[model samples]
Target: MDRNALLVGGAVGVVVVAAVTAVLVPGVLADPTDEGPIRPGPVDVADVSIAAGPATGETVTLGIETRIDHRGNPTQNVSVLVRAIDAESGLLATTQRVDVGNISRDGETTAATNLTVPREGGYDIEVALYREAERVDQAKRSVSGVSAIKPPYLQSTTSFTDTEALPPVSYSIEDAGEDRTTLDLTATLTNTGDEPAEDLSVTFVLRQAESNIVASRTTVDAGTISAGRTDSVDATATVPSGYNYYIDAVLMRDGVVIDTARGAANLNPTRTISVNQTTEDVELRVEDFEDDDDRTPEDYESERTRTESSAPGFGVVVALVALLATALVARRWRQ
Candidate 1:
């Protein structure tokens, strides 16, 4: 055979051998079984909120927020969008979810969105929240999308009428005998919206404006707050120091933060009650004051964040000396 003909013939023979090997390899291969669990996608459902106005032509914004879990823990990759839906038509409308774009997740997020209408009008805006899975609930390659727009808000779904807006929070701390402090704080949280917040938790974090958290405690498990009804969750956290310090109260539901209010651990002996769904804080200093304590005011410390509060007085003195030296130099130059 010629050189070119020989090369071509050799390639043809190799092709024939590969075809035969492929035909035999299928019969020789073993059956493969998947040993992994069936992984499901992310939860689509999330709580939503709407702002209502008395007069027409008012701008309305719908915010959708959800908690997505991966491997049974909350994931922060969730995104939300709003869409226009025919109120009574039960029809799949346009892909309007793209207009709103994705909202950023701030640590754990609560979004406030504004959707401007054409005129003073009201239509059922079907909002959708999307979640992208980095690693899905199951150990497998997956993608997911769920929708929970029909459900009410996660923390609160209703609004309060004019009459039911509880009074502001009022509280004070009193000396409960020696080396003990009792903080009496009161607030009323009414079920403003339609749905109920289950496992509603209210915690009071008493922090010193000068120091970090001098004392704190979870005040209420507050069962199920009924719709349109108001309930109170007031607690007295006993600590060692006089509540000369002040801090704010934080409200959380299902390990999620919702609202916070200005609170004062005032050294007030007067007893008071906060009527509104808010908090009242008070503090009382001891009649006899001594300055020789070297430990934390209380032992039942939940969380302590030490900041740059109590800096040594030496720094202040040095700053004063530098200022004096600068002034003396200016005076000599003028002379």
Candidate 2:
């Protein structure tokens, strides 16, 4: 009940009230409708697919498709980065960037790009989604056996007919003599493509069955053949008689061999042989030794002896002549 004490207590109470009001008033008066800073929506790589494109000698193009899913608020300046890394070497083979622009809706958007790489090994394809130059999500896919893809130039439209029912190579004996035989070789080809096959040639090689020696070989042009059509080319070969031969047919285009087939020619009348059959040991034919003048064996031996005797030394010749004269005198004394 002192006046100064009561006044000091009142002042302390007022200061405490003011401090509580300062702390609580702003939080109570804050607007409930206010929303905080606008953040970008979530963008994710939904799916990824890859397809093979045109192929050249050692390189090929791959088409990459990336699907992005957008949720929440709209996104701006979206893009997809595709990379091809060699699986074995862990080195980057190729890369490409595709712009997807703005993605406003909450759906999927596709981004496509092409990546060219060597057609030798497998690769790991990586797709990343970027928003305003910032990466949001990424995905990966793998492909193998790239070397199985064939180039355009090496893809042949025509091939030899090889089947159990039909053979590609066949031969006919045109003429057969005592020492030689002539064959007419035919090679059948099938064009399986949509376009005509041109600039083709076939080579016929006649190899002896027993010796594997090339007896005769000939090349002939194969005319243009329509698509889905089978045609034959002909060649002639003259081989030695009394032997079996294998007729090999080689199909070529622009000097490159595309296909090959084999047939057989049985020229021997006494012994029959085939290309796939094993060869039997045969007796070799030999002739008797004779002189160029058609002399017999006895005549040759007599001539050889006479030439040897004529080359004897002078002492040997004088001894022979004296012996003959002594023999003649003894014969006369006996008479």
Candidate 3:
């Protein structure tokens, strides 16, 4: 062959080899697997935070920042989950999921949801990325400045009962079904007093231990219970999973809570509520996941205050180090 032709042929062969290698290199290095649909890489939770929302007292907006970056294929129809957990009680207060219509090959987005803080306290805000039911990535952060409001009815005392031959109350968990994620409760209010109990309201509050937050609250009208007579009212409430819950029935008359009773029932089998849900056009409102755990708002504030106070000191140290390096360089140059 002619020398120039031979060189040109050799270059063409090298180019073909390079093209084949470029296509096969990644597969050779990657884990061997059976033939299946190609899977997208995981997304990451870059940052999580909570700030005060538009509503005052025990309501805040949880902010979750997600990052998705991969050289391979991109991900679509992914879910971003944000949960608020009480630091003290270890119970989840609320969870919100944002269905990312589609995430490009490389991008970052922030999704936020409003949640009621069970009480004024510190809380752990968790953010996670999910593909179907599988978790991709997650991150957690601490937050503070949640304010707790005391109910006007029971401000000074833990509970109250009228001394004047008050109405005797009984509470019952009529029927509880775990499959349906709901509980049915009944409250019977007896007018033991000589006079009739009028305008009575019976409320059932689902209480989780070690926290002031009520998981579910519903009211039933007792109307009027004649002397020595009883009136029964039924209440249906949706229960969240992951914690032991008991029902507290409070009998109220003319806007004042008078008699109260507590009843226990087992409902959750998995002992954890699933917070993931579908996305919507407007704000996403998650109902099942709620926050009822205990936490210390002061502790969260103290940590933030300490971090803010030390930032200036860190800057000073960095400046001093730079100055010292400059002085040493000058000395060395002179020597």
Candidate 4:
């Protein structure tokens, strides 16, 4: 047994030495440029910081401002991702991703990521700008500036009311069914709007590739949305096979349609929200995934199970453990 143990130890040493030699070979070592240079172009992300924002659970948003180009074009399609690490162990805790829409005409973009952080703690964020798939530029954030956050999902809106109604509308069975369909319908109405709405009637307009509707209502409603909160009537239609269709939540006031947008509902259980719908042919929205978490329950359970099962392995280690156990057996000149 001792001889076999020595042979195994020798083999382990040889393997370790070979691995070291392989790493030391020429062209094997990493280049010094592995740490890429931070060259911020016309846009500056100096203020890009991660903060716990208002989401149901532990959600985070990166806040930042951009320095515009001389032409006053804001940085388009900024991708900000945050990865939280354990300050004590330096272990990666969580990762999140967000996409900020086109920059303002003044070349300014704020740090609002679609990524949701499921847990709370210190995190490091990377702010990047991309044109297509290629990264045009990016910047890393410091952990010190990462603000701590807590819970409560509430939006303070003095202008908007909690309870509102919709206009009376009838549906034309353009095309739609359980197997194949596309529902397209239009609403006509007016509004009694007093204040401008942050989320106008356009917000209720649900346009999905699965559905197509051309709503040309003569009325612009009250102002944006408030002018057209009326009662909802059945707007049903037959959806055609493979035809694109979307549910548009409409608003009406005094029998006239005002704004569009606000009819998007995920009630069918399909994960896609048609956020790709464009205003002026551009999409400007971000959403968090339902399964996103700082640490999944399965991961936590797996770690615990491994640790618990490892107790026996420690016993094996103690058993396989090499110890110099010497015994001094004295005898009185036994013949």
Candidate 5:
């Protein structure tokens, strides 16, 4: 072979060998800046904690804290996904995701998220740790009695002072006459919370012990009661003489009753009444008279009788009134 031909043949052979090597061993001569296969670091869910947050309306917020343990290598683009599922139905209630960026050290890292769920039943909280789009570890926790959480506006800081030594409701006779008697009532309240109680009122209702008839009712503005302090509200009520009465003091805020207390006034010399004594089991007696203001006891009785006789199905009306009164009394007695 000629020298030029031998040289060209040798160069072609070298090129062929290089092409074969490049096809057989892929990426051996690839770009140095190119990325390799992604091998996710070892991550495990170390701990999961759930804390209840303030409730609003029918929903309550749950704070989920997830602790991740990174043992092998550093991780990047880590995230935590929190889900709240109803324990009874196994249905998803809510979900949230939080990004914690990169975990470079070989220690523990934390990720947190908040999920809002209905305040009705128990829930199972699930936490999942992810590296980018791949899930690495998961954990679960359970919480119950979510309905007990109260909203901020529904929570009261002030309540009526209830103790044996310090009675919440008290009364004294202001004047006595043959037909009627005037009494002064005082309701003592205490703030057992951290914030002040504002825009409050106390309603005093006088009910005859024998018939459970409301003789008089009055409301007094209590204004603001400071935190960790005790305050009093005074009211006046006049009723017919020679009758024992039970004074019902209802603590109110924004027209809603929060607490209640009871006291007795033994105006009748013949019969003595105690606050704890039970009265007759009769339907709630709501006065039917449109205007009982400045009306005498005899006039009230006459009007009540006349109205009951004239109105048909008075028993149903009385039953509805009883239900309403029972609900009101229940709310008042609630702690």
Candidate 6:
């Protein structure tokens, strides 16, 4: 081959080899189990509430409240970013990033963040929902600035809004004392929310059965309790006699009803009696009658005369004939 032709042939062969290697080596060396990035599904954001917006000079800390809903597929490595923009100047005032680890398919989450804005002005808050690097949804709202010196309304206010459901409470009644007709109503309060519970009060009502009349009522305050913690309180109430009774327990926080529990109690003591029937025969025996030895001679003679007068004439004749026959036989033996 000529020099130029040989060089071209060598280059062609090298290119062909490189192409084959590129196609086959990847398939042969690549692990079949190595999968690529996961595609996330749709997400929805709604119900954004600005809980607090206390501003101090140029810096304002925003309390953003919102709910995130995941749909269709589960997502991992999710995050949320909130931005405060000055609507007049189109300037961004603050930004906050929240790391939402994972959300299951069709699941929902409530997110709250306190973002510190570096400027003081009227702004519109924007929330961007993301799964990894992709933005799935966005929401925005406008809010007024608040004073930093004063306490946040969301923290100072005693309302059930945004508060978790109260833990369950169970009530039981036991004797308070032996000398009195009073009972101790015990209420066990449990905290099921992820946050602390405060300003809790429980009201116990002991009512007569099937009647609205309250026999005894008392309220007990159970102070602050941590999440998943259990606390209890006792109240003394007089239980009346001769009537069935029940108990109604109400759990409250900031004058809002968190939970309610009801139970019945049997106050009147009682006894039970059972009667049964059986089939069986019984027998009786009597002793033979004997004459009294202590009887006087006059009494015995009177008794004998009455007996002789009452006897049958045939019985008397037979007795006399037997005696005479016995005497005759004895006399003949003697002769």
RMSD list, candidates in order? 25.3, 10.2, 35.6, 40.3, 17.2, 28.2
lDDT of 3 by residue, 66-139 (tens): 45443355676777777788988889888878887556566565555565665577788887777767887878
Q: On a 0 to 1 TM-score scale, where does candidate 1 land against the true structure?
A: 0.34
**By the lDDT metric, which is better: model 2 or model 5?**
5
Model 1 lDDT tens row, 141-259: 11111122222223354222223345434566554666666768765566766777567767766654333444555566656777777776777766655444444556666666566
* lDDT (Cα, tens digit) per residue for candidate 4, span 170-255: 23445445643434444434334454333223223334433344322222222443434432223334332332334554443333
Worst 10 residues of 5 by lDDT: 281-290
Best by TM-score: 5
lDDT per residue as tens, model 6, 1-335: 69999999999999999789979787654567877665666677967888655655446677987788877667787788988888778888778888888887586788788877654446789999888798878888986644332332223222222213432333344554443256766666666677887787888887655443576788988777778766667677776544445677877766656556665555444521111211222221111112256568998899899898877764878789989999999999999
Candidate 1 Cα outliers beyond 4 Å, as residue runs: 1-155, 158-168, 172-175, 268-335
Instruction: Estimate, for each residue in 33-79, the C-alpha lDDT of model 5 and write its tens digit.
Output: 87877565788899998888979879999888898998666778998
Every model's TM-score = 0.34, 0.57, 0.32, 0.24, 0.58, 0.32
By lDDT, the better pick of 2 and 4 is: 2
TM for candidate 4 is: 0.24
* Candidate 5 residue runs with Cα over 4 Å from true position: 1-39, 51-54, 76-78, 86-92, 99-102, 119-123, 130-136, 142-156, 170-183, 193-198, 206-215, 223-227, 239-248, 253-335
Q: Which stretches of candidate 6 lie over 4 Å from their true place?
A: 1-39, 53-58, 118-120, 145-335
lDDT score for residue 32 of model 6: 71
How far residue 52's Cα lies from its native spot in candidate 5, in Å, is 4.7
Model 4 lDDT, residue 292, Cα: 35
What lDDT, from 0 to 1, does candidate 5 have?
Answer: 0.85
lDDT of each: 0.49, 0.84, 0.62, 0.43, 0.85, 0.66
Candidate 5's error at 259, in angstroms? Answer: 4.8
